[model samples]
Target chain A: MRELSITTEACDTGGCPVRVVRVSGYIDAHSFPRFEREILTLVNQGNNRLLLDLRNATYICSTALGLLMSVFRQVRHNAGDLVIAGMSEKIANIFNLLGISKLIQAFPDEEEALRCLAAAEAS
Target chain B: MTTRRRDLALMVPGEAEYLCLVRDLVTTVARKAGFPDCRIGEIEIAVDEACANIIEHAYGRRPPGEPHVGKPQAIAVRLALFPDRIEVRIRDRGRCFPPEMASSLDIAEFAASGRRRGIGSYIIRSFVDEVHHSYRPGRGNELTLVKYLAKGVPGG
Candidate 1:
């Protein structure tokens, strides 16, 4: 089994706190539940603005992708946002093929995503 | 690639922990079959999605993160390499799935509908060139996915 690690951090951007959840490894059916629980815990705690750092994540199955879409809706409904960064072409291709990228904004890296989210939160 | 055919087969317990092993096997086979890096990635995801579906739905396992109290069943995976394409056949004794329902839906609408599942079929359909499903009363369900090495392969 591929190990999936989810570590979270919060950056106080003066307007809203941008929570960064960094995940590494395969987020397949076996691991998505933990991933879901971690993210939902943050959301339920009022940490809505999120940056999903998938830079180290090698692969994400359909189940996990579907969960992200659902989470995106939930975050938006709560007046918060969920964005992703550091996806390889392989991962990005899957997102594009499924149209998930169309709904969830993805940046090339964490720095760019943080900047964009910070700007949005400030404005 | 040559006209000569090559084949590979694997049977693993229907558990989420073995999903990565399936992906790794597919990747190794695909690379050896001469698929490019990008196409190889697509094939890996397609096969992974299919096997995941079998483990979760066919074997009656609970959703992710939940334990399955029942004993795990066997998932048989067969790969055939042809001159122009590669075909993966996954077999399980679990319930049958409607092949007609494997269309790539509008992701935005599906997501907005608040549905969590039904994306596995979408991924399998989008990544592979063709999907064929058949089930027998006692022979179990077989789902075959084909991917062409190039864009214009006949029937691909």
Candidate 2:
């Protein structure tokens, strides 16, 4: 199994300060710590508006999903949002089955998620 | 008729890397056993949850120390590939999950709650074909998960 790699960057969405974290490879027990660390760093830095691009993500375990929910809670409590974007149908189904869709917002693409986050922040 | 069989065991320190290794191995084994892409994903998720439970409950975050108190190896994952099914057995020498905890977990309830942490065992049961647990008085606990592939698949 390959190591899970998460890349973070501040995406310039026509003036909205949104951070995009691209998670690739497998997100099982092994890579969850790194995932938690990066999300925590983003939250601690006060960058709460997040768009997680999972277009390249091959797998995500319940542990990873749990961490995402924890981060979402932290962000929401701080008046920010964590959005998931570009999840594969299979992965999306897992999220849906876990009822994550009800707790966090999801979009089909990064651009749409960014737009939604931007609009929400402006309101 | 008997199917081809492959069995191996891994003794992993309670570290994140080992968890990934287990997932990889399980996925590969499932694929080799002719599981469809969708089923492979299911097996991967189930295996991860089982292993994560062991790491968190058995080893308690940090790696086990020298002279390993109870068992020289705190955790071990065993994989057995049969013609029609793949069985993953995770063994840990830690406090067993209280019978109450095991009995109270209802998959339907957890699915409705959507709370992240408590759904592991439930999810494992829902995704796999069969899930069994045994706590031998002196031998510690073992969680066995089996996924049976559909007939048209391949390995068998």
Candidate 3:
């Protein structure tokens, strides 16, 4: 079975501590469990400021997008923030088409997403 | 059991538009089978999830191509209506699902995470009354999903 590689790190943003997770792989039905596990682990740890770097994702389906929205709702309920960054145009367009961008903040890069999340938390 | 019903199959391509087509077809079929709006919506979501999995994972990221030796030009979604239930089978000649990978998933973890990310099969199982998977050595993979339409079920 092909594995999805997910790495999380603490971002040094000036405001709240943001956890940036970079995911690289096919985020389809097969590999979605791994992706969900990593995100839930971080969320359970109170790492609400999430920056998903999807630049390396080759494919994403509606199921994957639905899962992201579920996570976003969970974080929001906990009064935390979730952000996505570095998504390819195709992935970004998918998010937009699904109206996910309206629910969660998306940025062009990790730094910008982290900065924005920090700024929002500070204000 | 002698009630005659219609069956239709559409080749779903990897393109995203096919998702909508499948959704519309499933909704129409469910409605014709006497399912209410909410039930039809649930069935549509389940079918969409299944077709999306076929397009994205079964076929990988390959673009639309001619029907090849082992690869079909589109994923075939077959629907059969019975007197009291509906059976939908999705067949694909692409990559078969690995048992180990399919078995490793934890549905509780998915529920806890509240992430709808990878629970296509789970969704299918929950929405439908029965779900089955089989693979013939030379025939490829087949997923059979059945939903019973009982009277007074709020949507039947």
Using lDDT, give the best candidate's number: 1
Tens digits of per-residue lDDT for model 3, A1-123: 124688888876775888888888565444666777888788888876678888786555556666677777788788887888888765665455344676777888887887788788888
The lDDT of model 3 is 0.68
A4-83: candidate 2 lDDT, tens digit per residue: 78898898676778899998888766566677788888888999888999999988877677677777777777788899
Quality class of the docking in candidate 3, CAPRI style? incorrect
lDDT of each: 0.83, 0.74, 0.68
Interface RMSD of structure candidate 2 (Å): 5.0
Off by over 4 Å in 1: B62-71, B152-156
With a 3 Å backbone cut-off (N, CA, C), the pairs that clash in candidate 1 are none
Candidate number with greatest DockQ: 1
Estimate candidate 1's RMSD in Å.
2.7
lDDT of 2: 0.74
- Which has the better lDDT: candidate 1, or candidate 2? 1
Candidate 2: misplaced stretches above 4 Å? A77-79, A119-123, B1-9, B63-74, B98-116, B151-156
Could you arrange the candidates by TM-score from highest to lowest?
Answer: 1, 2, 3
